[model samples]
Target: MTLEFDLFWSFRSPYSYLATPRLAALQEEYDVKINVRPVYPIAVRIKGFFKQVNPLWPPYLLKDTVRIAEMEGLPYAWPSPDPIVMDIKSGEVPEEQPYISRLTRLGVAAAEKGKGMPFLYEVSRIIFGGVKGWNEGTHLQEAAARAGLDLAELDALIEKDPDHYEKTIAENEAAQKAGGHWGVPLMVFEGEPFFGQDRISHLIWRMEQKGLKKRS
Candidate 1:
């Protein structure tokens, strides 16, 4: 019996970017399929999640992740311009309704085409792959191409049909019903839920315990 894991992820998370390449390689190592499900980040999904994060979260997370990158032997650089959706103005960051909305919609669109992982990989490269920077006038088009994707076509699809995109997000929420979690980067395997990039190893261990057969 083949096993499949649903990996719910968000593009804005640094950890998500770090986990992408490794997750992509797992297909070659295990007899299982990873269904990448891109979702809105907590800041977008929850009204005030970011504000509630620990005061030291930003610096601490940055320091800790750099250590992880060194241990994993991966290039680590703070994303240029950052992938966050909020904007600071008048000494107060605005709600960032539009940006977050667009990201969530686009994520759903990619998932609908069964190209979630591909899209995530391409997009994350622009944000975290030590590229110049990812922004409105950035080289996103070129980056997408490098990742074997087409930016123009993806934009058209999302622009032309938004309802379908909304539905995909809804479907993901429903699928997580059994797991009792609504967080991104949530990996659900055999009804067990492991959330966050840090949980990937645990997820693989669980898969192994469930009789994950190694390839011959």
Candidate 2:
């Protein structure tokens, strides 16, 4: 029998980027299915989220993500033209966000096609793995291809029915909250929410308890 879980993720999250490879590995090594649920980052979901948080959080996050990447041996860098357009110093997010909306919509589209995890892993790596102008030209196109998807097709699907994609993302966000957390890289199994990249091992332990089997 195959076990399945929902992966609540975000493009703007460095931890989500870090978590992708391991999540991919889990599916490769075990008979488990991961349903990718893409949601807008907290900065977008909760207005003034950054402004209300501790001032020390951002720098610590940067230091931690860098160290984590080095420890994991995954290529890492802060995204250029960040998915969410916000002033880092003031924590002011613009109402007109050009990047995150499109990216989240595309992620929903990928999920619909059952290729969400691969698409996100490939695309996030491009954005967070030091690619300059990651959104320009063939960058996304090539990434989609690597994930066994056609970027143009995804774009056309979104173009044809953008509201549906947005609604799907909204539902994902609501489900994430209903599952008990608002953070990215959350894995929900059997209605239990495991929040954080560090909690993956615990998730697997629980899976093992439930008789998770290796792929033969």
Best by lDDT: 2
lDDT of 2: 0.94
Instruction: Name the top TM-score candidate.
Output: 2
Q: Give the TM-score of candidate 2.
A: 0.98
lDDT of each: 0.71, 0.94
True-vs-predicted CA distance for residue 127, candidate 2, Å: 0.7
Clashing pairs in 1: 8-185
Candidate 1: segments with Cα more than 4 A from true spot: 87-100, 136-138, 174-178
